[model samples]
Target: MTNPERDPESGKLTERYSDEDFLEAVAELEPASTREIAEAVGCSRRNADVRLRKLEEAGEIRKKKVGNSLTWFSVE
Candidate 1:
């Protein structure tokens, strides 16, 4: 695993599942909210959301709607 590519325009490093650091965080704290994931990864919720969405789209993760919030989990 390696670092996610930085956004060329924003100059911010975007979170991605392929990132070693992000993957380690997720392994320890999945079935978590975007906020939790962001905290664990030391990223913004917006950045975590972006990565989570990508994982969901890639079928690597799944989300369950709970009340008005969502919890993410790794696909098993």
Candidate 2:
């Protein structure tokens, strides 16, 4: 899969991404907390949480409750 490209002007991503992109982002940040995943994927924490839940349910990743927060890890 092609990596998302960054905007030439602002240097931020300007394209829409698929769930696969989010999965790749999560894998890049394996053992990442929700916030870290969101930051890495350029998504809001709430949006990241929703996507993470789906990924977890699909067995693409794992979410472990650590203290008061959840940490995500790549299944691979």
By lDDT, who's the top model here?
Answer: 2
Best by TM-score: 2
Listed in order, each prediction's TM-score against the native is: 0.69, 0.73
User: Model 1, 1-76: lDDT tens per residue?
Assistant: 3457889999988645454555566667876888888888877888778887877788877888888777888777
Clashing pairs in model 1, backbone N/Cα/C closer than 3 A: none
Query: Which stretches of candidate 1 lie above 4 Å from their native place?
Result: 1-18
lDDT of each: 0.74, 0.81
Local distance difference test, candidate 1? 0.74
Clashes of 1: 0
RMSD, one per candidate, in order: 4.3, 6.4
User: Model 2 segments beyond 4 Å from truth?
Assistant: 1-15
Question: Relative to the unseen true structure, what is the C-alpha lDDT of residue 17 in candidate 2, on a scale of 0 to 100?
Answer: 50
